[model samples]
Target: MLIAMAGLPGTGKTAIAEAIGARLLRPVVSVDPIESAILRAGIDADQPTGLAAYLVAETLAEIVLGAGHGAIVDAVNAVDPAREQWVSLAARSGQTLKFIEVICSDVAVHRNRLEARQRNLPRLSEPTWHAVEQSLDEYAAWSGPSGAVERLTLDSVEPLDVLVERAVEFLGRPTSS
Candidate 1:
C-alpha cells in the first residue's frame, strides 16, 4: 500500500499521516525535510527545490513499495501535477494507492495552529497567518479522474484514532491489531 496524504499547510495532514504510518509500521516519506535541506544548502525552494524534493520522494517511495513495504507520503499536494506524480509512481511500482486529504473545518483553530507552529527544519520558514489565509483562498480542490485513485477526505476535528480507523476501512485492511 502507498498512502499519499495531501492538504494545505496547517491542515493536520502530517499529523494524520504520522499516526497512520506509525500504526501500520510503514515508513513516512515527507517532502518537507528534503525541501528544507535544499534550502539550507542555499538553493531556492520556490521551484527548483520543489521539483528536486518531489523527485527524491518519488524515488524513495518507489524503492519502499518495491520492497513489499507500505509507505506513507506526507506532502502539500495542492495541485493535480503533484498528486499525479505520487499516484503514477505507485502504479508503476505495482502498489495500491490510497489518497487522503486532510482539512481543518475550524478556521480560527487552523489559523492559530499555523501561527503557533514551530519550525523543525532550520532552513524552513513558517508561513504567517496571512500567508496561510491566502493559500487557503488559492488552494484548488482535487477533482481528478474517478477510479484512478482511492480517496479519503477527513476532518481535522475528528480524533486521530477515528481518522485512522476510517482510513483502515477505506483501504479494506483489517482494523484489528
Candidate 2:
C-alpha cells in the first residue's frame, strides 16, 4: 500500500500520517526533513529545495514499495503535480495508492495549532498562519475519484485514535486472524 497524505500546514497531516504509519508498521517518508537536510548540506535555502525534497521522498518511497513494504508519504501536496507524482509512482510500482487529505474544519482551532507549533528541526522553518491561508487559497481541487486511486478525506476535529482507526478502515487493512 502506498498511503499519500496531504494537507496544508497545521492541519495535523503529519500527526495523522505518523499515527497511521505506526499502526500499520509502515515506514513514513516526509518531505520537510528532506528539505532540511538539503539546507544543512551547504545548499542555499533560497533554492527550490521543496521540490528537491519531494523528489527525494518520491525516490525513497519507490524504494520502500519496491522492497515489498508499504510506505506512507507525509506532505502538503496541495497541487495536482505533486499529487500526480505519487499516483504515477504507485502505478509503476504496482501498489494500491490511497490519497488521504487531512483537514481541520475549525478555522480558529487550526490557527491556534499553527501559532502554537514548535519546530523540532532547527533547519526547517515553520510556515506562518498567513502562509497557510495563502496555501489554502491556492490548493487545487481533487480531480474526482478514479479507478486508479482511492481518496479519503479526514477532519482533524476527531480524536487521534478515532482518526487512526478510520484511516485503517479506509486503507482496507485486514485485522489479525
Candidate 3:
C-alpha cells in the first residue's frame, strides 16, 4: 500500500502522516525533507524545488513498493496532476493507493498552529499563512471517480490517537484492487 497524505500547510498533515506511519510501521517519504536536501545540495530556492522533491519522492516510493513493502508519502498534493501521479504510480507498482487529506476547519487554530510550528527542515523555511492561503486557493478538490482509489478525508481537530486509529483501520481493510 502507498499512502499519500495531502493538505495545506498547518493543517496537521505531517503530524498525522508521521503518526500513521509509526502505527502502520511504514516508511514515510516526506517531500519537505527531500526539498531541504535538494536546497542544501545548492539547488536555488528560485528553482522548482517542490516539483523536484515530488519527483524524488515518487522514485523513492517506487523503489520501496518494488521491494514489496508499503510506503507513506507526506506532501501537500494540492493539484490534480500530483494526485494523478500517485494514482498512476500505484497502478504501475501494483500497490494499493490511499489518500488521506487532512484539514483544520478552524481558521484561527489553523493560523496559530502554522505560525507556531517549528519543524526543523534544514534550508526549508516553514510556509507563512499567506503561502498556505495561496495553496488553498490552488488546491484541487479530490473529487471525481478515480476507479479503485481509496480515500479518507480527515479533520485534524480530532485527537491524534483517534486519527491514527481511524487511519490504521482504513488501511487495514482489503484493497479495492
RMSD of each: 3.3, 3.2, 1.5
Query: How many clashes in candidate 2?
Result: 0
Off by over 4 Å in 1: 45-47, 173-177
For all predicted structures, in order, the TM-scores are 0.90, 0.93, 0.94
For model 3, the local distance difference test gives 0.89
Lowest lDDT sum, 10 consecutive residues, model 2, at 143-152
- The sequence of per-residue lDDT tens digits that candidate 3 reaches over residues 51-119 is 999999999999999999999999998888888889989989987788998999889999999999998
**Residue pair clashes in candidate 1:** none
* lDDT, residue 173, candidate 3: 91
Best by TM-score: 3
lDDT of 3 at 146: 40
lDDT of 1 at 34: 84
lDDT value, residue 55 of candidate 3: 98
Residue 159's lDDT in candidate 3? 91
Where does candidate 3 have its weakest 10-residue lDDT segment? 140-149
